[model samples]
Target: MAAAKSGGITAYSVKTKTKNVPMVDPVIDVKSGRYIATGKDADGNKMAAIMSKATAESHIEAGNAKKGSGWSK
Candidate 1:
C-alpha cells in the first residue's frame, strides 16, 4: 500500500480487490464528458478515479501531473 495523502487521488484495484489504493504519477484525462485521473498502483497495476474538472486542472497546473490524451481543457 502506498502512502495515502489527504485530498489526494486514489484508485480501486479490482484485480486485488483493494480499496483506496493511492495513485502514483497521476494524469488527468477527459473521457465521455468526465474528468478522470489515472496512474499505477503499488503493484504497478493501472488504475483510475473520476475527479472534478477543477481538481484535474489544479493537479495539472501544480506540476503534480499532466493532461492525458483526449483532454480538451
Candidate 2:
C-alpha cells in the first residue's frame, strides 16, 4: 500500500448507549493488515461495514486530486 499521506488516516468517533446512557469514544482501527470498521451496535450486537478495495482506492485518488489545481484554478 502506498504510504498514506501524512495525516491521511483519521479516527471516527462512535457513540454507544448503555442502558439508555450514551457513551462516546474514538473507534479503534484494529485490523491486522488493512484498516476496517467492525463491531456491535450501540446495544452490543454484531455488525459489519465493508468496502471494496477498488472503491477505497478511487476515494483516495479523488481526495488527492481535489487537493490540487483544477482547470478553473
Candidate No. with top lDDT? 1
lDDT of 2 by residue, 4-70 (tens): 2342322222343222121122122324434343334445554333334443344346452122111
Clashes of 2: 0
Determine which window of 10 residues in candidate 1 has minimal summed lDDT: 1-10
State the C-alpha lDDT per candidate.
0.75, 0.31
User: What TM-score number comes out for model 1?
Assistant: 0.73
List, residue by residue over 10-70, the lDDT tens digit for candidate 1.
Answer: 7678878988887778887788988878799878999878877777777777666778888
TM-score of each: 0.73, 0.25
For residue 33, give model 2's deviation from the true position in Å.
5.6
RMSD of 2: 13.5
